[model samples]
Target chain A: MKFTYQINGAEHTLTLEKHPEGYRAHLGTAIYDVKLLHAKDGQLHFQLDETRHTAHLAHETPAKRWLHNAGRTLVIEKAATHRRGADTAGGSGRLTAPMPGQVRAVLVAVGNEVTAGQPLLLMEAMKMEIRIAAPHAGCITALHATEGGSVNKDDLLIEVEEIPT
Target chain B: MPQFDRVLIANRGEIAVRLIRACRELGLSPVAVYSEPDADALHVRLADGAVCLGPAAARESYLDMNKVIDAARQTGAQAIHPGYGFLSENAEFARRIINAGLVFIGPPPEAIEAMGDKAAARTRMQSSGVPVVPGAQDLADDTKIQQAAATIGYPLLIKAAAGGGGKGMRIVHSAADLLEGAAAARREALHAFGDDRLILEKYLTDARHIEIQILADQHGQTLHLFERECSVQRRHQKVIEEAPSPLVDESLRAKMGAAAVAAAKTVGYTNAGTVEFIVDPVTRDFYFLEMNTRLQVEHPITEAISGLDLVHWQFRIAAGEALPFQQADLTPRGHAIECRLYAEDPANGFLPATGTLLKFSTPPGPGIRVDSGVESGSVISPHYDPLLAKIIVHAADRTAALQRMQTTLQDTLALGLTTNLDFLQAILAHPVFVAGEATTHFIDQHLPNWQPAPDIPAAAIIAAALAELHSPSATTHTTASPSQDPHSPWLRLTGFRMGGGE
Candidate 1:
């Protein structure tokens, strides 16, 4: 079986084949003889070559997994075989909630022209206030966040159309 | 016997757990109160009794003084311990608890009120012969604010009069930004603390935040527990704390400790309290910042060095005990460092993260203490503070303590959500931090753009791949057994079987 995983925007492919003694894993040009020592409840104890490592893997979604080992955690996602093109409608002008929080105020209205880095909204999360700003000089085309409304991570807060230089 | 046999802990999170343990050690029945979402919180499970306050919104539940008092009454609790935050520092809440014939395991209402307001505290400290930062307060209008700003000069701070934890603070570099900065600070202050009053202070560049812990009994004896250095801060929120500040010598320690005791005495404070100060690292001169009438979040480091359980003392003092020792008898033996473990993304503006803590583990060994409120399978809700735990380490010296803390952080693990663990390690490894020369601007000046190392280890990738292959969902494409096969080297992992495993 061939598996492709993405970490920090980079993709790596791993191929695994059944072996009589254990399993053979091919990661790039390096081949690894892997032996599973113990596996239970998201905790995996395995040996790759001469090193023994313990890692915990938890699945957040079908394609996303959190892998932790030796005090480090990495967000690993199964890379989609079919890649999508860039979002042309909003591009860099789309503003989203950085984290789950409540919109404290909306500083800009639809159709308002904003300079780069202009404050557009205020959000409250974990008892701290954060200011959301415009990414570039643009005109607000849509406003999705309302005052005192709750928003999830990556939820669209605003959309802006870029102003030509 | 103590004055109260049953005590209600009127808070949640790690502090509540810490108080519960202390109550048990003192042979008192600890009762816990929780909001709707915190029904299964670790504190509730560990307490002898628990009551549901209300919904998840803090205002409706934890912060609702009426609900908390009523819960204590119904639970048959004779005393209430507001373990920091929530209603811990609220003077009205303390008075209400007393009026209800329950012992409030903190200072008197008069003390809380006097020191709760930062501006008022500054005035009182100045009158008590304590050095105060040059600033002005109670500026009701733009004209008064402008006058104060002119006197304080450029690079001043606009802070909320009723603020802590840096919620309503703004720094203005020059005259041009004064009015705008004050307006923004006022709005934030009103929203966060329900008070729009602002105070102006001259910004102290590269100053260290040192605080003295003072304990007082109802019998009028007050003694200081020395000092804790909390210089590693981000936006005024402390990220790391240590005891016996590297900068303070015996003479400075005695001076700051005496000033802290005098500050508490001026307020007639009782139980455990901390007096914060802003100290110039070069001259060793310190100015009174504010007095926390309740226990502080970083009290564990002080406890580590002083060999005193502050919570135990709070209970004893509330029970009408007298001081058993003199100030000279209490001495710090070693160095202790504490790092706050928060469920926030350090690489992403330190924004809080919420999810189920699928895997939670702590380092276990001598001189290592982990005060936490969550366990595996616990949910990190968005309705409360994001502090998950506090990891503290103690050793014979500062260098040994720092090294132990570094290893302890490396040994601890939390998965299934973003955390500041790696960022904490980075801070521990920084040259300035290791040298113990960090000030309040440590995070900003040293690691303003810190990001976790981009490279992922190959072993992690291989483990994830193996786990994926062993998952029950992958059984469709391969003939791997769903159960652990004795003859096979690969053990089939169970739990969280995706896609309706057969």
Candidate 2:
């Protein structure tokens, strides 16, 4: 599968695949052999090695460096995440979850005018505290998800109508 | 042997991400293994492939070696790199890897076995003129221990022979403290190292913990890669590490290097390893402690100073290649220091805390190198080592290195999750630390409520409030009346950098 992330307002495509060693990512790929066990609050976990990292990763997500692409705003992700010199679209933008979280605070009413990189709302996944920033100048034309709702991979929270001129 | 085009990292967090980079450098495809909790992990998204291993508890996932090896086979992986503190040091697991015909990128099982038992290694080193500390010959037999104590003198250390990291060890200042200390050491040794056999050693006060890096190829060219001063520690666990120890003059370095070489040679070692020693600061005398028969957590510091690729060399040596560099060619350059980033509260006695990472940041500048295993949206649990990342700084001199460290820490931020940030900051500012006079007991001597000084006062609390106010994810957004609810919904924002994610 592929994901498009914006860096400083430039959209970069990322290709993510399922792990061969039994990993299944909803947005990426499905891996066989690895199993997922359910936990408290319907949380699923997986252990990778014959040690504790898997568990640590499950409970402690942000501490894992591998998940951090450590690059520009638009990280391609994956081994191919090293794409440089890619063209930046003039009118492209994105609004991603600021923190790995669910949408908890959607203060914007649709069709509201907003500047580039303006604050949209709050994403509340993983106890992650991020003020989702607008990717480009636009009007809040559509509300994709509702406040006080749970969302997953690629769940659209809100849509912006690109403002011409 | 079938070559696997891609090898999946069967873990999450910073180590997993670090391994993925290493695999990329090694020309192998990396598969990221993650739990449902880590769906957003950087390693998983970055690897060529990803797999869900199991649930969050260690027993079901990372410790599930079968699933891991099977994942490798399923991914058509030819080898697996077990990063430290996980399956990286498990000898039985290594045997299993060999039994299954998958390359385990670590030392041979026999070598691991030899050194795993601290007592056994002590015996081997003693015979090889490795100058081990004087201690009891075996687990304390009441009578034998009494005699050994009388012979070895007072102020002895009862340690688990097969232990590493300060687990299963105790200091006995007198005969009155002997039996209890012995029991504590024995029990801890049994649990941590799975070996109950222990020995007593003469405890030297104010000893600078130092170790020499060594690399051995299959053809027997074992080279010493100088020494690292790991004197800064807390509870016997190393906290800060630097190469070409400040206290080690040329003569001391030469002597210690020779001893480390002898120790590795005697063991017929064939991989990147570390031989630890206790150097008495007052007299400048040193004694052999133990040998770690694998790459160390502090290897990057050694690499920073020596300009060597220990991991890449491990892979090369495993591939049956002659060491590319000769012993005479190896030399260290500028000084380097490493501080471990852990998820614990020093104010709360370093108690480990688990939560989703709210913010993560790291400093990026010249002479700063960082190795981490976690990212944003990642959760911290109590299932593994509390360490989250390692921040290393290199500079032309010790003073510059110290300054560099302070700068790096100031720029780094770990928000949401509790961490030892304050502890590390306190350690950096310690009087003894400033003067370059540190020992393993450094943390014990100077920590009660270790905290990092914010560039401004009330920075943490105010930032939390501002972040909550501006946060797009704040569910309650009750920064105003945090006292209203029991949860005390305080919003946490880490600095905008790569090193601050806790």
Best by DockQ: 1
Which ranges of candidate 2 are over 4 A from the true structure? A1-165, B1-11, B187-195, B449-502
Against the true structure, candidate 1 has what lDDT? 0.85
Instruction: State in Å the error of residue B417, model 1.
Output: 1.2
| Deviation from native of the Cα of residue B144 in model 2, angstroms | 0.2
Which consecutive 10 residues in model 2 chain B have the weakest lDDT in total? B474-483
- DockQ scores for all predicted structures: 0.13, 0.02
lDDT of 2 by residue, B246-295 (tens): 79988888889999989888767887888999998888778888888777
TM per candidate: 0.81, 0.70
How does residue B142 of candidate 2 score in lDDT? 71
Model 2 DockQ (Cα-based) = 0.02
Docking class of 2: incorrect
